[model samples]
Target: MTTPFSSLEDYIALPRVESLALSPDGRKAVLTVATLSTDRTSFDRALWEIEADGEGVPRRLTRSAKGESGAAFTGSGDVLFVSGRADASAAEAPDAPQLWLLPSRGGEARCLTRLAGGVSSIAATALDGETVVISADLLPSSRSIEEDAAARKRRTDASITAVFHESYPVRYWDHDLGPGVPHLLALETPGGDELPEVRDSVETGRSADESRGVYPSHLTSPRDLTPTPRRSADTAGQALTPDGRTLIASLRVAEKRSGRFVLVAIDVASGERTSLFDEPGVHVESPVISRDGRRLAFLRAPFHTADAPADQEIWVADIDGGDARRIATDWDRWPSSLVFDRDGTNIIATADHDGRGPIFRLPLDGSAPEQLTTDDFAYTHVAVDASSGDLVALRSSWTRPPHPVRVRADGEVFLLATPAGAPAPLGSITEVATTADDGARVRGWLLLPDGASAETPAPLLLWIHGGPLNSWNAWSWRWNPQLALAKGYAVLLPDPALSTGYGLDFIARGWNAWGAAPYTDLLAITDEAVRRDDIDEDRTAAMGGSFGGYMANWVAGHTDRFRAIVSHASLWALDQFIGTTDNSEFWQTVFTPRGLTENSPHHFVRDIVTPLLVVHGDRDYRVPVGESLRLWSELAEHHADDDGTTPHRFLLFPDENHWVLKPQHAVVWYETVFAFLDQHVHDRAWSRPAQLG
Candidate 1:
């Protein structure tokens, strides 16, 4: 049978690839496709290869059941990609989807490392046609989704907040020493070890089940890997050496909020390691050695402090270790996804310093970086031909979908192909700046209802994004402002105080000051939106999930400005959440040390006035269903008051987790939301059926 959804547009719109990597020769480009299942079927993902100059239709190179895409070309013509599948018996098992190999020129795909485990990270450089330097992961295994789904719902023997954590870490490759791989070496360092398996919970003295976080460890060469544990070195950055000798990595031993890291160089064969320069004051990010492999260029920034902006500087250090100097000091910039031109003369990196990421070129000798594009979009992803240095970058704006573009050295830009299905021209989209109660001017991008006029008030939806820290940009996508705009509602997203992109301080302000500034900004935005002559104040509604859900909950309790509210996967009870959710680290760092207090949401439940339709996944592990249940249960008790009576409803998607990943669930979701919003915000009247018509 055909799917219930009518058009592919509704079922799915955009191609699921968010990132891409080009082969050194730039003859082929790899597409990293992350797919969302149609139902609770199998989560499928694959890597598709396309010709660099728009000469080939994208062809799927691999069929993967558990999502395999980080595909890239080696110095040799051979291709290396992260290929794996879910352990049919476990969820994120360390023993599932071991590393595999494939030819760049298409041949048999073989399992390279049968360590019988999943690899979180992989780096490959061709020494010959058959050899490549690689890093794979080995972690403690857990039950698979299917296996866990097979079990009956069991009550927990103990109480816990954060649940269902999978702590998988990447380990460097040395012992297996894939045959003939050049620089096939291991560096001496610390950290990156598998945690002890927890057979069962010993609840009394021990708490609930939890995954162990990564620790500082010594990276001893295979010869010394046994345990004369030297100084610690930990890094999540790709563990690769260009010249194939000195392995450069960052150590995560320091206690800093910025996740401060230390960069150290290790001699793979000798197991001897030395700190390039201990960046104790802050953190150092991914370091890229020049193509010639003589110098290391990495981004450095101060540690994250409560009230400070993490200033970042791009610094280049000699491989032999000395004369480390800062080259780039734009606080607004950082090294984006990096790709060096195969010749190694110029380093290519993407930057979105001003909301739109354009490409920038940094010389190997640490000269000034030249901006490559004028129109903002993400220039961070580029496919530069190793042979000619001809660059192909993906660009998009709020109004534009990302499409690959070709840039010639002469400075001319050529469009490769329109994004798979570009949206029809937007009738009218304008940025609106509105002032809040505290005189804070919030900015928002407003998409107008096609047939509506300023004289005629339009139905409006004030959509709030969950990461309250995340900012709303001009991007056409699913479940975003586009969905509501197409449904005929003017969608408005306010760039409230705590939103990102403004600076680090603005983001940090969002921590413990949740309902304080954010709530205030939301109310001011709503009131300002209502004041506009083109809006229908009485027909307005609100919707958001996670942090957005918290806003909806708080708005309902404090104001009657909104007719209806939609809360999805939200944290409603801060008091209970600190002690109940798995986000205690965030709570401790961002919120308060004292935990939940008497001023929590449950204690202030009397403030709610607007009706709410609470939606959440039954299997959500992040913010458990317990939070939703508590909010809904409590809101139900106060459904009516002296002022007026409002209806409240609850809907749960079973088997779905924090993210509603299935297409079927999305269809059901949109329909339910439309029907609910119409019932409340439209203020329509209907007669009941009488006398059995």
Candidate 2:
């Protein structure tokens, strides 16, 4: 029997469930499932509903060509989501994503907002589900939706694609910041009943019935909550109190050259704002309100300097920002996301620990964080059931993509039946670790092929993780080692120096010296992996993306042990990267100029002997295409033969961003990478991908 794991085409076609949303009543849950579209060029997402108690099979809730995402349940159990699907009732359907509602009493979904720029995201829903807050893009100078639309049309008519910037970061990871800034807007919904006529001419700026179809008479106008926002609400983390009277959010406060996020509470009705937790050199984000809306649990991270990196501390405080104190102070792991437990006495959070992301229960009394659900999987989108106190989250690992699961209060985890299903088991994963020369511990996950054994050793692929700060703890669709395992290669996913799962000290070891400890740590872990009986040390290659790509470049110059090296969206030259990257100000402040030059891989390019493959997307504003272009140019300048040829390759995706997102592009990315590895490591002929031709 052939499994999807053995074939790239089959693997890409498998249905994937990525996020989970639980109803307030805890009777049902909704999941966001991604499946390959009929065209196979893109993945379309849809919402699915399942029994929260695990009693019934999952049922499809909503479907459309454009698909639905950002699924959240209103207090009344009505599902609210963002979709760009056209509405038959409207004269002209929205082309951009708009807020939609799926009534709890069972009816067809309805369009809720038709902003010209579309709804950025659904922020929060009131307890009764009447008041809803959404994030939308508005022109900084526009006073109303009509004016914003007019301004946008004017730009389109003039064919002006340029963005005027007054801020430090003009672009984000993959796109320009904009002619418009994100603002929080609050609106009122009628739940299962009909909405009232829209008021406030400035809010809607038109006859509601003419613009909005069907329920125009029932829907109220969306009120601008952050009227004078200056990009402060861009990608802000917000939570609405159970009473829906106030909204707690993390707004970016722009500094001279950098910015720090501070917590703020906004009165939903009056649009009044209050500073909650503001501290210099520190960021307060990921705010979560208690079930009773009495307390707040959020993450506090101080800015890192060139000398040292700071830890992210979990802080608990009163709803009004009084008597705030940090909890889990002694814990070494850094939490990524958190939520208040049903009882409000403990905070349920997920953090990278050792080599896995596990859920931890941090008591308010501050004894220690209790580890829950001992497993090899990482969890996200965790929601606590107020009635049963059970947890529902999306969990995944190397063996599986994200799937919905229910976690009991006592720590038992049960897989919920998902319509998306699971992929075929491909490889066995084991933990690998080694001690650095400095006596510090380094660890990673090693994925082994099915036939890997002492008698039948497998070639090794030493894959590095991107976030110099990230650990290889969760399942990654973009860089799945399971595909490599299926291709009969043993993959070494190392969490070297600067990885999060380890203590702050481990990160500080590589603080300003990126090429030193991190590079050596990768080598140490690789050395340990290649020593295993089922690994062939002679046939090995190194590959990474982003920061990992930088390390790949570093490894290529520092050692010829790996037969081939692949770097994607990498930093070949440190100084060039720091200045060109979107968040230059932050990087400039974090690393000294001397440190950037000393650790730069470009300086040592003349020493690289291994075959190199550089992959980058032109739209990658984070790393930028210039990094790869310079690396390629330098490789040619120093290593190219007189015939104008070299043992190197560059794969560029003009439409892609920091990552190769489109399905076809992703396939080509893997094909090119695999071909490069086979050509150099296995001594096979280079095969050009047909798609490129």
Who wins the TM-score comparison?
Answer: 2
The lDDT per prediction is 0.57, 0.87
Q: Which portions of model 2 show Cα errors greater than 4 Å? A: 195-218
Task: Give candidate 2's whole-model lDDT.
Answer: 0.87
Q: List, residue by residue over 97-141, the lDDT tens digit for candidate 1.
A: 544445664665544332222333454343222323344322112
Q: State, as a TM-score between 0 and 1, how close model 1 is to the true structure.
A: 0.74
